[model samples]
Target: MTELSLIRNFSIIAHIDHGKSTLADRLIQVTGGMTERELKEQVLDNMDIERERGITIKAQTVRLDYTASDGKTYELNLMDTPGHVDFAYEVSRSLAACEGALLVVDAAQGVEAQTLANVYQSIEHDHEIVPVINKIDLPAAEPEKVKAEIEEVIGLDASDAVMTSAKSGIGIEEVLEAIVQRIPPPQGDRDKPLKAMLVDSWYDPYLGVVILVRVMDGVMKKGQQIKFMQGGTVHLVDRVGCMRPKIEQLPELGPGEIGFITAQIKEVEQAKVGDTITLAKGGATEALPGYKEVQSVVFCGLFPVDAADFEKLRESIGKLRLNDASFTFEMENSAALGFGFRCGFLGLLHLEIIQERLTREYDLDLITTAPSVVYRLTMTDGSTQELHNPADMPDPVKIDTMEEPWIKATIYTPDEHLGSILKLCQDRRGIQLDLTYVGGRAQVVYELPLNEVVFDFYDRLKSISRGYASFDYEQIGLREGDLVMMNILVNNEPVDALSMVVHRSQADPRGRALCERLKDLIPRHMFKIPIQAAIGAKVIARETISAMRKDVTAKCYGGDISRKKKLLEKQKEGKKRMREYGNVSIPQEAFIAALRMGDE
Candidate 1:
């Protein structure tokens, strides 16, 4: 076992596209973790979607051996975390397992919204942060300006910041040296009982459940009995290992070491992230402070395009949940979309990632409903309920008061785009909290309804700012609002999947936009199909899909006017009767198109 002083545990934290993963690649290569032939870009990002999007979804850990200038080998455990706000929980968990963090800043872009957010989290975890100004090779890079911004905005000293171009292999040696010289080693005692923190876990087809752990107090070895403190489930450890970006078997992991273990656990749910693991026979009496349960903010329904694929969809979702514990789902059947499941996600990006994974990995076609935020409802009977789906809402008369979730959002944009960005936020019923100028950029903070920002707000911000704006938000608790459920009816029948909760003041415009979009999406039927958006007994918007006429008078050529009139009347009566009994067969494409109204 290596001495505690020779081991360093740290994570790389930065904003999206700020070269966190690239820096990881450079470190792994220089330390000879992988040979040149086997090395590639983004070696830690294993998922196809992650590589394609050039973003890290899951935080990856690797153990590297580096020979410092003093001729001493040090064991460095580096966690490469995601930079997006949707994956902030991943960053927090990584920080909890590390003693320090490399705060990477884009030399050209300077301090962004996520950069500040992540740095604050690192400070909260009491991590020793070493600033690294990355991408200095860029033509617009100004390392000195970025260093000043780090000191002014984040309050972190940047006088000794390291300058490196991760892509070109510049200043890599200094980065490794700084990690060894500056970051402190983890503190733990091997003589105590086994107390390891479960950082993350995923399901492996070959090995049931693969758990990533950081040993805090004692030794974790193969063939030992361990218990999950939160779950109270015991299992026999089958294997113990570490990742060099590839699995390397180890006989035992001592204190202050990061490694993995397979305990013959059946599912990842049994091995909760942030849970304390200890010896089953003689474990610690008190558990460590674990992470809070993740709350899903956005809710939407996922239905198979074909009814026959319902069972397949269920199996696919269950398997996906094995790896992603933050994603929650429940079996729900919709009248309009047939059998499906209602899934809850942390945010819009999380929902998109899950949907894309289901379609690409499982090869299943899906139709997603409109996304909505959770609401708290107080009943006249002095009871409270959380509303996930609008279709499941209680009677309006029984709802004494409704409170919708709110969020505190911070946006960083260039000075030129500040006008449009502020207008966009204000148009969404936002209350501006503060606005300040940092260098040539503007930082704006606003309190906006979570529902308004859920639909296409990020996309709009990106487009208006020419992709120069960075946005991040945290959910503040719910507040009382004049919210009402808007229902969409096709053929005078309400579609549960198309229902949503909206603020009363903006309900009319939102309802009208949806009704108009559906008018164009739904195909022409045999009889007139009247589509209406309504709240309670009042209709807010209406549209009609004209009937496909057969031209009953076509065969009455050269006939008298009276004969043509009689035939037309007969056909009109038949059409009216058919309108009452005919069911509008809305194609799957229509549902998909109508739900994407936010894009328009």
Candidate 2:
């Protein structure tokens, strides 16, 4: 077993595509953790979606043995974390398992919104941070400017920061030396009662459910009985293992070391993330602090394109939920969409990842509805309720005030596009609280309604900023706003999944835009269809879709007036029957397309 002083647990965090995974690959290669034949680009990002999108969707941990210049071999447990704001909870869990962090910043892009947000999160955890200026080999790289910004913006001393190009393998040795020299070794007593934190967990087909944990106090060994502090469920440890890129069975995991353990657990909920694990015989009296239960912020309805696949979709989601505990779903019935599930996610990117996984992994065709934010509903009887779906909201005339969740948004962008970015933010009902310049870029802070930004806010921000802006947001509690539920009615019938909560000031314009967009998407039926956007019983916007014309007089061309009149009467009778009994068949694409009205 390695001494505690020779073990260093750290995580690599940065903005998306800022060379985090690339640097991780370089580190893994440098330490001989994986041979050339075994090494691949973004090796830590095992998910196909992660490699295709060039983003880390999940937190990955690996153990590396490196011989430092000091003639000492150290056990380095490097945890790579997702950079998107949606995965902040996952990032925090990763940070809790580390003693230090390498804050990677792109030399060309300098400091981004996520970079600063993650740096602050690291600071809050009191983790020793080593700022690394990456991509120095690029033609546009400005290491000096980036180094200065790190000091000025992040308030970290950058003079000692390692400047490296992960692609070119430059400064790889320097980074390894820095990790050994600068980052403190883990400090914990091995004689204490067993205390470990379950940072992450996933389901394995053969091994059942496996959990990645950081041993904080005592040793964890195979055959030992353990109990989850929060869950109060006990189990016998079937295996104790370490991640040598892949899980390798370990006889025991000592204090300050990271590894995985399975106790024959089958359900993912049994081994909860951020929960404490201790020996069942003699465990610590109190659980660890900073345990956070993951909650979903944005919600949407997910339905199978084929009605017969409802049960299949449910089974697929159940399997997925075993691996992803953050996502939540419950059965829902829709008027337009048959049977489906109302799913909740962390954010937009998270929602996309799950959808992509369901499609690719489970081979399911799905139709997703517009996203909605959780709202607080207060009634006249001094009662309160939380509404996630718009259809679940109470009546507007509930005799009391309604409040919607608000967010504190922080955006970092180039100075040249500051005006347009701020204008876009204001248009989204953002209240600008402050604006400051970091280096040559602008850092703008605003308090905006969460409902406003949960949909197309990120895309719009990227558009107006010319794709040079980075955004991060956090909930700032609920605030009373002029909120209303806008519903889309096809042929004067409301589609529950298409209903959304929008501010009154922007409701009319948004409703009109949605109605017009849906008009082009929904195919013309045999009878005229009226697409209307309504708030309660009041129709705020309307668009008419004309029926496809088929001339009934063509067959009676110059035959006779009586024959022509008879054919016309027959057509009229058919049209009346169609209007009375024929329901509009909205394709799955139309429901999904309704959410993309602002994409163009």
Candidate 3:
């Protein structure tokens, strides 16, 4: 076993597309972690979705052995984490397992909103940070400017920050040397009873459940009976190993080491992230401080396109939950969309990723409803309830007050796009909290309702800023708001799938837009079909799809006016009867087209 002083655990953290993964690839190459034939770009990212999107959704770990210039070999545990705001929790968990972090900044892009958010989390965890200025080969790269920005924005010392081009393998050795010199090693007592933190777990077709763990206090050995401190489930350790980008079995893992363990666990749920693992007979009396439960900020419904595929959808969702614990769902039936699950997610991106996986990985076609945020309602009887779906909202009269979730958003943009960005925030009912200048860029902070951001705020922000602006936000709890539930009616029948909760001031315009879109989407029937958007009994907007009229008078050209008029009267009566009894058949395409808001 390696000495504790020769072991360093560090994670790479940065903004999206800022070269975290590329730098990781360079480190693995320089350290000879794998053969040149076996090495590929983003080797740690094994998922197909991650490869296509070029974004790391899940945090990945690997163990590498490096020999320093001082002629000493060291064991390095590297955790490559995601940079998107939606996966911030993943970054946090990865940081918890490391003693230090490489704070990567794009040399041309300088510091961004997400960079600040993640650095703050690392600082909170008391991680020793080493600054790395990446992409120096880019034409627009300004390493000095970016280093100064990091010092100004994050207050981290960047005087000795390593400048490197991860793409071309420049400064790769310097980065490795910095990691070995600057980062501290983890401290643990191997003589104590076994105690390891379950960092992550996932299901395998052959291995059952594979768990990634960080040993804290003692040695974890094969064939040892271990118990989960939180779950209280005991099992025999089947295998002990570490990933060199591929699994390599080991006899045991000592204290301050990161590795994987398999205990023949049947399900991933049994191996919870952040749960403490220890020897069943003489484990520590107290458990480690685990991670906080992730709160899903956004929710929506996912239904199969074919009604008969509901069971298939259920199984697909269950399988996905085994790998992703943050995603949540519950059974709900809608009159318009049939049976489906109302799912919860960390953000809009998380929701999109899950939906895309359900479609691509499971080969299932899905219908997704408009995304919504959780709201808290206080009743007249002093009771409170959380509303996930607007269709399930209580009557307005019974709700004493309704509060909507709010978020504190930080936006970084070039000065030229500041005006449009501010206008976009104002249009979404946002209150400006602060404004500051960081060199040529403007840093703006706003407090906005989560419901407004849930729809299309991110898309609009990117369009208006020309993709130069970066934004990050954290939920600031719920606040009282003038919110109401707006329902859509087709032929006087309410469509629960089309209902949503909106602020009072936006309800009328929003309702009008939905009605107008539905009018164009619903096909012409034998009788006129009326579409209305209403708040309770009050109708705010209406549209009518005119009937397809057949000319009965075409064959009566030579007949008298009375005959023609009688024929017309007979046709009108028949149409009136049909209007009273005919049911409007709305095609599936209509629902999909009408739910796409902000496109117009």
TM-score of each model, paired residue for residue: 0.97, 0.95, 0.97
- Candidate 3 is scored at a TM of 0.97
Segments in model 1 whose C-alpha atoms lie over 4 Å from true places: 553-561
Question: Global lDDT of each model?
Answer: 0.92, 0.90, 0.91
| Model 3 agreement with the true structure over 1-600: per-residue lDDT tens digits | 779999999998888889888899999989998889998888888788888878888888999999998999999999998888887766777788899999999999999999899999999989999999999999999999998999999999999999999999999999989989999999999899998988888888889899999999999989999999888899999899999888999999999999999999988878877888999997899988846667889999999999999999999999998788788999999999999999999999999899999999999999999999999999999999999988899878999999999999999999999999999999899999999999899999999999999999999999989899999998889999999899999999999999999998999999999898899889999888999999999999999999999989998768579999999899999999998899998888889888887854
lDDT per residue for candidate 2 within 1-600, as digits (tens), equals 789989999999799889999999999999988999999999999899999999998788899999998898999999998889898977888898899999999999998989888889899988999989999989999999998899898899999889999999999999999998888998788999999999988889999998999999989999999999998999999999888797789889999999999899989888878899998988999998888778899999999999999999999999999888889999999888899999999998999999999999999999888888888888899999889888987777883877888889999999999999889888889999999998888999999988879778889888888899999987779889878888888887888878888899999999999988889888999988889999999999999999877898886657569998888888889988897888988877877888776886
Span of ten consecutive residues with least summed lDDT in model 1: 285-294
Cα displacement (Å) at residue 159, model 2: 0.8
The residue-level lDDT of candidate 2 at 87 comes to: 85
Off by over 4 Å in 2: 548-578
Query: Arrange candidates by lDDT, highest first: which order?
Result: 1, 3, 2
Q: Model 2: number of clashes?
A: 0
User: What is the C-alpha lDDT profile of model 1 across 337-413, one tens digit per residue?
Assistant: 99999999988989999999999999999999989999999999999999999999999999999999999999999
Q: Cα RMSDs of all predictions? A: 1.5, 2.3, 1.5
